[model samples]
Target: MDGATQFAVSALINILTSLICITLSWWVLQNVRLDLFLRNPGGIQGKMLQVLLSIVLGHGLAVFFIDYLGWSGMIGQLF
Candidate 1:
């Protein structure tokens, strides 16, 4: 493919990965009861923690998915 086509495909892949990561993180946060470990689950600190956890988890999962699909090397090769 040409450079423009390759760039478009790469952009789409990135967007899809981000969407998957957000969905997975949101599902976990909504279904899991975090009160088990947190002192105040609904407090500001707890919410901040939740956001941090979600971002970390999402990034990890996204990386895992990309690696599992053998796209990690492709990304490195592309850029």
Candidate 2:
């Protein structure tokens, strides 16, 4: 493949990755809220807490996974 083909492939991969990350985050919130709603059927505060917790947990997991994937690339630099 030539330069143009390589660039297009890379761009496509990047776009797909971004979309997946966003969708996963949304899923995290949606599913958590659903559970919370069922558990606390009459509590407004509980639902609010559920949304906040989901956002925090989702971001934490995202950072953790990114760092783990980057570990191999970083290993040799400190050697």
Please tell me which predicted candidate would have the highest TM-score against the true structure. 1
Full-model lDDT for every candidate: 0.83, 0.63
**TM value for model 1:** 0.70
Q: Which sections of candidate 2 miss by over 4 Å?
A: 32-79
Model 2 / residue 17 / CA error / Å: 0.7
Q: Least accurate stretch of 10 residues (summed lDDT) in model 2?
A: 33-42
- List CA RMSD, all candidates: 4.5, 6.1
lDDT of 1 by residue, 1-79 (tens): 9999988997788779967896789779887788999999999998888888888888888878767766656677886
Best by lDDT: 1
Query: Which pairs clash inside model 1?
Result: none
Ten residues in a row with the worst lDDT in model 1? Answer: 66-75
Task: Give the per-residue lDDT of model 2 (tens digit) for 22-73.
Answer: 5577676655536534676447966666656655666666556666756865
lDDT comparing candidate 1 with the true structure: 0.83
